[model samples]
Target: MSLLRIVFKSLRQHLLSTCITAFSIALAAGLLMSVWVVREQSRRSFTQMDSGFDAVVGIRSSQLQLVMNAIFHLENSPGNIEVEDYEKIKAEPGVALAVPIALGDNFKGYRIVGTIPEMFTHNEYAPGKKYKTAEGRLFDPELREAVVGSFVAQKLNLKVGDEFEPYHGLDFDEDHAHDETYVIVGVLEPSNTPADRLIWIPVEGLQFMSGHREESHEELSAVLVKFRSPLAGKTLQMKYNQPDGHLTMAWPIGAIVAQLFDKISWFDRILEMLAYLVAVVATGSILASIYNSMNERRREIAIMRALGARRSTIFSSVVLESASIAAIGVVVGFSIYLLITTTAAQFIRAQTGMVIDPMEFHNVMLFGPIGIVLAAALAGVIPAMKAYNTDVAQNLVPVS
Candidate 1:
């Protein structure tokens, strides 16, 4: 028989152990690739996150929270800044454009943000990419029409002609639905940004909503600002970042996100280390599994030699079995990766407003699984050599 046939026979004889060995390797490989994917994909998403905004102007509070809540929609607002404060930021020197957003309501759990048509008119939400109306025109600020994000439309089954009343705050409760209903005038193409989950109406419309009051009246959650030139960012930071300043600016979304990831980088490293440890355990499992079966197979090896099979043939069969397990395990591991990433992709997008493509091929493909196979092959060395050295004279007499 060929080496593969012999290998298959041996593996079939030990089905349970073979499955356990393959699955352990698969788990280790999946864990390794998963960690690599999260690290790389998140890094890429962070870099491309938001562009064209020089600064995020908001009430004095946690700068990280301000940026995350205002741009990414990942956190709650620290506080609101009045419309006057928003306009003041817009009027600041070197400020070329400022889009105001007022948040305090939700439409079935999706946030209802009040912003001017400039949100659709500006390319700053993403660098050089303007928001395109997928179905209808941008909502007129004079009316109570709304524009929904792609995800919002998909999740809520909303269309341009649909009209819905928003609830108070972020909870998806019907009891808090306000008296006023807003018509959906437009649907935005997927921008892969937080705005995709928002129900954007006129800033004036939000101010007139039920939660509005003098304290939060005409107040904005944040002013997304763009400078006439790159130099304006330095001026905005130097001037407004003060302990007594009513508002602060967080500029160049890239830096803010970098800082955020840097803080959690250690956690990623720990995961990577754990992945390696799993791999080590998987290798040991393969080694122990093959080693323990060696004694039982010694007589078979002796009989193979008695039947004129070469020592090298027995060795090759053992090695092939180990390598086969590794190969199958890697494929299983990749399948597991696909299942998880595909399942979580939409969820991650909805929660963090960052797009994660599970199938976006990465460099990890070249190395992670290949390393597992090599480790598995190495794990078979002792077993393969032991099988090759079987003594036909000593073992053939004992079988009876």
Candidate 2:
């Protein structure tokens, strides 16, 4: 028989053992693939979110909270600061631009952000390096018209000419509804930042709707400040706070990314530990299954040896058979993992407002298949050794 035929025959004789080995390898590989897909997509989403602005200035509070609230629209704002304070910073010597933000409402858990048209330009978050409306026209400088984010429009099935009543606060209760209504004059294209999930309106309109005018409103949510030069950030930060000021400023990109990683670090570590544990257990199971099958195959190995097959040939054949089973298992496991990831993508996106593409592959996936094959080869070593050292002469002699 040819070498390939010999391998197939050996596997067919121990079909149960081969199946068990393949299943274990497949399971380990699937788990590894799922983890890699989730991690990589999350990183991509975060990187896109981080590219919008330089610094976020808000009420004196935790720098991380300001970033989470302003950049991601993930958490509630840290109270509010005076609009006049923001105006002062906007006119500062090194300040290139300052976009005031007024946030206090939500439509189905997504934030409504009130800011100037200049915000889209200053932050470079606009489409095609310039702000352009995907539907209808940009918000008129007046307070009654609003522009909806792409996700908000799609999710709510909203379009131009739709009228939406603003709520008094983030609460969705009917009682908190504001007296004035907003006309959706425009819809923004997907920018893949907080902009994609927010409802944007003129800052003056928010103040007018909220009934704050003349005197400085004590509650301005946050401000996006751009410096003339990168080095201007440190200087502006010091002057803005000034030890007694009611506002604090931080680099939004750095703060948001840092806090996100910090928050997920423990979870990532747990996942890593679980992955390693699964891999080790899978390896052990594959080893045990192949080793146990050796005794049942002893007569077969002896017969082959009696036919003038070299000891080395018998050892190589056994190891090669186990490796092939492991390889097949890895492929099957990866398919199962893809199915699970694709099914969960929509649910994850709805909960986190973060898009995940599960079909994307990363280099980390290679480890899973490689690990399975190595483990299978290592497991066959002991059984192969036993088969190689078999006493051919004694077996052929038979009892009397």
Candidate 3:
């Protein structure tokens, strides 16, 4: 029999342990790749996230909080800025565009934001990518008409011409539903941005929605600003961030978002360390499994030697078996990675409207599996050496 056939026979003899070891390898490799891919992809996507605007001017508050609230639709508005503040920011010398948004209600748990029609008519959420309606027309700024985001429309079974009462505040409440029934005039196309989860109405609708205090009139949540040049951001940031300034500006929006990842960077490092530790433990398991099986296979090794199998051949077979096991695990590990990453992608999309493609190839996918297989093969060296040094005469004795 060839050395490969002998290796296969030995593996078949200890199939259960071999399978268990391979499974451990699968878990380790899958976790390692998943952590790496998710971290890299998330960092890349979030750092590049944009709200079609370069900065947000809002009441003095945390820059991160303002960006999250205005751009990501996360966190509560820190406070409200006056309409005069919005006009002043819009008329700033270097300001290219400014759109104010008012937020206070929800329709079926989806936030209903109030903004002017100019946001859709004039602004590009990204370079040359203007918002387009999939269904009807943009909401009339003077009427109680709303434009629903694609994700919101899909999740809530909403369609153009459907009318619904706005619920007071961000959270949905049955008793606090406003008397005003806003018609959904349009459903926006999927922009793959945070806007896809919102229900947008005229700015006046949200500010004056029933049950809202009259004193809060003319107060804007934030003014989304786009500057003409980088220099403009510096000029504006210094102006708005002054100690005497009533409004704060979050300039270079990407930097504000990146700070979130920076703060949580230690957590990612911890996860990566745990993944590496799992990989080390998995490699050790391969070593232990093969080494512990050595005594039982000694007689077999002796018989192979008697059959004229070279010591080198026996050694090579042992090492190859370890490598083969790892190879199989690496194949299965990719399947596990697909499963994990797909679920993660779904959850992330549901929460943030950001799409993460699991099949998107990364360099780690190539190097990570190769590294695991090599480590596993190295793990078999001790057992392979023991097989090579087997005493032929002593182990070839007849067994009862």
Q: Which candidate ranks first by TM-score, i.e. highest?
A: 3
The lDDT leader among the candidates is: 3
Worst 10 residues of 1 by lDDT: 46-55
For model 2, the superposed segments whose C-alpha errors exceed 4 Å read 1-5, 12-17, 126-131, 210-218, 241-243, 340-348, 351-354, 390-398
Shift in Å, residue 184, candidate 1: 0.8
Choose 1 or 3, whichever is better by TM-score: 3
Q: What does candidate 1's lDDT look like per residue over 2-105, in tens digits? A: 77888899999999999999999989888888888877787778656764576788988877888888787778888888888877878888998998888889
Q: Model 3 Cα displacement at 110 (Å)? A: 1.8
- Root-mean-square deviation of candidate 1: 2.1
Please provide, for model 3 over 226-305, each residue's C-alpha lDDT reduced to its tens digit, 9 standing for 90 to 100. Answer: 99998999999998899988889998899888999999999999989998898889888888988999999999899989
In angstroms, give how far residue 121 of model 3 lies from its true place. Answer: 2.0
Steric clash pairs (candidate 3): none
How accurate locally is residue 217 in candidate 3, as Cα lDDT from 0 to 100? Answer: 82
lDDT of 2 by residue, 194-215 (tens): 5767788887777667544444
Q: What is the full ranking by lDDT, best candidate first?
A: 3, 1, 2
TM agreement with the true structure for every prediction? 0.93, 0.87, 0.96
Which 10-residue window of candidate 2 scores lowest in summed lDDT? 210-219
Model 2 CA RMSD to the hidden true structure, in angstroms: 3.2
